[model samples]
Target: MLILTWVFVVTAGLALAYAAASAIGAWRWSVAARNLVAELTAGRVAPAASRHHAAELAGLPAPVQRYFRAALTDGQPIVTAVSLTQSGLFNMSAVADQWKPFTATQAFATARPGFVWDANITLFPGVPVRVVDAFVAGEGLLRPTILGLYGLGTLQGTGEIARGELLRHFAESVWFPTALLPSQGVVWQAVDDTSANATMTDGPISVTMLFRFGVDDLITSVSVEGRATTVGTATVLMPWECRMSNYQTRDGMRVPLTGEALYITPQGEKPYFKGTIDTIVYEFAP
Candidate 1:
């Protein structure tokens, strides 16, 4: 009976130590994330014209114009920054369907097109993986950690990773529709009645995406060819796509509440990230 009591005490002490470590690690990570977000939003200034108007849509592609008309209202304030919370499933396997549930909070700065996404994925009960995917100062960063302490891997570079992160920023612009407008550096070209090509450039990186629109004038999907993806230890360019749905009005603007990202491999479409937005708060230009 004494031995059993000792074992219980030891186990309880170990569990308490682990919980304390995780709490400290999470606090440190949160501090770092706030610093990164500050860097992303620094030097941003309000646009000369901070409100949307129908006149701004002229000369854009037909589909692009329709999308703006449906997504933004006249005199609507342009979004300068955004923060949102999300919950959903993240696929852990590259070739198989091993999905884990996750919760995330993201912040975006539209003036220079940057974002930081902080997420926690539950590997199993009581075990969580923390990840931060960000694009700031023309550099892309992907950092994943177990319990916010031990990093599993870190990916950052100037070429493919940077380009890929920028592409992600541009593709996800639908949530902040005004960022896709001409005044915001997006160049739209008509692809068809239902599709258009939108290109954006930031410093040394430039990307183009094909946006498909539904009859309601909302974005159906955004696709690009030659996005860099890691296979084993090598990096390769592959076709990638993001689909948006469940449009709802928020802060006088229409935005998608659910989204999914996938890679179009030679075999077929392999979806990896699927998320639903829980709440969104916007900081409009003054």
Candidate 2:
């Protein structure tokens, strides 16, 4: 009985020690996250100038410097921004080659009123979907101006766009297909990367917005990729890649010049959709 009692005592002590250590680790992680975000925002260009110091920042994952050199570009600030509800058209081969309209709405912000937004998604055209009426929860840069004029036609309960998917895609869409984006504002974030994951048709693929910056420290392009399977087909899988590029300036702010999407199925089917935006009518109304 004494031996069993001693074992129980030892086990309880070890468990308590483990619990304490875990609590301490979580606390440290929280504090580190706070400091990291602070550095990302206020650190800005000054932080960029000090590459050695920038490397020390805990805001981004250590691999961030290697994967995203734009974060350390000259004159570029640690920009956080958003793309509000954008309505577009898309066509898919999974659903009897059905073409439908899609409306994507996101609400975001930054610490400052300045931000550069480059976001795009492929949709079915000739379907003309309308932005009925909607609201964004996180009001970063658009809190005072852009939000009001935009999403004026959004609808209620169509659904709220997930902010996490928005940020993950935001990281990808910022560069490559587009010029680049730079700004000092608030944007969205996600714990997981969704674009690279596998998805099925009729599974209601939540829209993803890829973000990265281009040359001139301005937002150049944005892209969203989605996939699905044929509803009643013989186990056929279709993969799609859509990218929006070509940026134009309206009243000093840059907007995408053209948006393009490509859909590919294992059965040799490629449907293409493209859009040309003539002018951007919105501005940062500070």
Candidate 3:
């Protein structure tokens, strides 16, 4: 009986320690996300334009103008800040396409082009990986941890990482359409009638993507050439694409509720992320 009792106590202690570590990890992530959001908000640039006007769309590409007309109502207030929650499936294996479930919360500052995305991916039944992808003040960060406690990798700096994160911010502008307007540092060029090229520059990095509009005038897909993709310890340039769907009105803006991200690899298209927005909140320019 004493032996059994000791075994039970050891098992219980192990479980308790595991639970404590998990909780602490979660708390650390929360604190990091909060601090990053504060920095992004404080470092935001003052708006050059506050509201959307139909007349301003005349000079943009035809498809871009159509998109804006359908996505925003006249005199719509420009989005300055945004926060959203998302749930999705992320492909874990680069070779096998093993998909894992994930949940994430993201915050964005439009004026200065910054964003922080905090995500937790379930690698196994009880193992979760926390990933924080962010860009601020022309720098980028990508950190991943096991249960938010044991660091797997922490990537940060300028150049490719920064450019990649900026590209992500620009592509995700579909969720907050006001950020894509011509006045918001996005220059649109004609690419046929159903597609357009959007170029956004932040500091020394400039990224461009081809945006395809559907018949309903909603953005169907965004594709870019030569986005930095990390393969092992080395990062390589690869073609990337994000497909969006399930249009819905949120805060008087038409935005995609679902999205999938993929890499155009030599073997063909390899998707890495499939996500749906669970809830979103917007703060417009006053």
Candidate 4:
């Protein structure tokens, strides 16, 4: 009886230590995230009207130029930073499994290609998961915790993951039309009458995406080659695409408020994320 009681005490002590460690880790993560956001916010500058000059649009393809004209006003302020709320369905598995509904709030800084997305994912009755996914200073991190105590998964890296996030930021530029201006990291090359190739570079990472516009001068789809995705335990480069629709004019800019992210594989295209933006607020330097 005494031995059993000692074993129980030891187990309980170990469990308490683990719980304490997890709590500390979570607190540190939150503090670091806040600091990163503050730093990005402090470095921003007000949007310059000169940056969106008509001359800059002269070199772009016709469709690309039309897209800029249709999406952004001539003197509209450039979106340096943005905060948005989104609700979506996220598929956790690739085997045609059920998709879990989620609501997320995100903040993005265009200059550094940094973003923080916090999501609440409902998997079952009374069981929900909190996910914090972020890309800061060329690092990508995804942390999902249950009940704020136990960690479900963590995928973090600086190479492939960071590249993937950079591509993601480029795709999401549709939501922040000013970021797609030629003055930004984006450079456009004519592909055809309705399509253009955009090369976006942030620091050492460079990615090219093909933008296809519809007759209305709205971007209908974006496709990127060599985007990274995780397959089982291996990280592989795959073709990825985002289909945009449901255009809405907000803050004097036309933007796609609904989109889906898909992975194009040899078998077929698998869409893993479908989201609708609820709100988008832009910020500039003071």
lDDT of each: 0.91, 0.34, 0.92, 0.82
Summarize candidate 2's per-residue lDDT along 95-183 as a digit string, tens digits: 35565555443322232211222222223332122221111222111111121122322112212222222332333333221112212
Winner by TM-score: 3
TM-score, predicted candidate 2 vs. hidden true structure: 0.32
| Models sorted by TM-score, best on top | 3, 1, 4, 2
Off by over 4 Å in 1: none
**Which of candidates 3 and 4 is the stronger one according to lDDT?**
3
> In terms of lDDT, which candidate is strongest?
3
TM-scores for every candidate against the unseen true structure: 0.96, 0.32, 0.97, 0.85
- Model 3 CA lDDT for position 3: 100
Poorest stretch of ten by lDDT in candidate 1:
43-52
lDDT of 4 by residue, 1-286 (tens): 9999999999999988867765775576567557756765665544444346666788789999999989987767667889999998998776575799998888898776678887777877545667877777777777788644568768897888888887888889899888888777588999999999998876777878999999899999999878887788788999999999999999888999999999988889899899999888987544
Q: After superposition, how far is residue 4 of candidate 4 from its true place, in Å?
A: 26
Tell me the number of clashing residue pairs for each predicted model: 0, 44, 0, 0
**How many pairs in model 4 have backbone atoms within 3 A of each other, for residues 3 or more apart or on separate chains, i.e. clashes?**
0
